[model samples]
Target: MLAQVRSIGSRNACLAAGELPGGPWAARGGRTYRTGASGSTSEAITRARAIRSVTSVRGYQEVGRADLFIQVIPFASPEDARGGLTELRGLPRTMPQSKGLSDVGELRTVAPPTIAGTTHVEAAEQAFLLDGEHSRTLTVWCVAGQTVVVAALGGRSEAIRWPQLAEIVEAQVAALG
Candidate 1:
């Protein structure tokens, strides 16, 4: 899926898994980046593979008191992303977490269509809050044909910076059109 999204070359991008300061993500694949020690780079990348027709770039680092993993996965089309989202929606209920954290709130629903051939679905769950500090996740699906863009953002509350996250998503819709 990550490879497929990279192949499709849509403008949407996702944040890497790790610690991040509160702010707009850098301009890498329209995504913010960070990493963590316990993060599963392989699992995230594996999930990324499920989407078709995408490309992926993974970056790992240790910044602050945590490990940083950043992946920039782009999709071929909005339809593909939507399809990917559909697949990811199932993860929240089935996938396991690191432990100690609790599910805060989750918003899962199929977004409106994008372009003539693409669709979008969004599912976000506040998987955990570290030491009662900060942790949130927002996953989006951009689908077009067999391609998909699955953007997963996870980190300490301070690290998941992307105030314009919603704007980036809206831009994705416009690009899909």
Candidate 2:
């Protein structure tokens, strides 16, 4: 999935991953990376094999003491994108363990506001308490058309509100266009 998004060409992919100017957050340490089409790393290869025509971009930022990781993946077609979206939507239900975190929470469906002129869009949001204190929120959006734009935002739960998540998704869709 990630590998596919990475191959979508650097500039647009980076924008889609939330490397926006004067946004709520800035890239952590101004550090960012982009992978080429021929990814050699084991993780890259695994992600590449999982999704068809996958390309991805990623950006990282710090919000207070919390870290935000943003990722965007674009697929070759809507059907392929829908398949990836379904797989993502099922992750919370299929996984019993939250890596090492004990306070796992349910994944809830979010009614994504219509992004006018976007081909198709779907979204989901989830929040979980880490170590029984700090909260983490994971919000994902998938837009389908000639390419499927899969965007995700992860940060300290309380630090990011639903409105902000929606804004991020809207920005990504606009960028994808």
Which residue ranges in model 1 land beyond 4 Å of their true spot? 1-84, 92-119, 144-146, 156-163, 167-177
Q: Candidate 2: minimum summed lDDT over ten consecutive residues — where?
A: 29-38
Using lDDT, give the best candidate's number.
Answer: 2
The runs of at least 3 residues in candidate 2 whose Cα sits more than 4 Å from the true structure, single-residue gaps closed, are: 1-7, 10-12, 16-24, 28-54, 91-102, 131-134
Position 107, candidate 2: lDDT: 68
Q: Against the hidden reference, what TM-scores do the models get?
A: 0.41, 0.59
Model 2, residue 143: what's the lDDT?
Answer: 54
Local accuracy of candidate 1 as per-residue lDDT tens digits, 1-177: 335344455432433332233332343333232211224344443444444323443333233322222233333344434543444455444333556666555554534323333444343534466557567655545554444444445566665533433344444333433
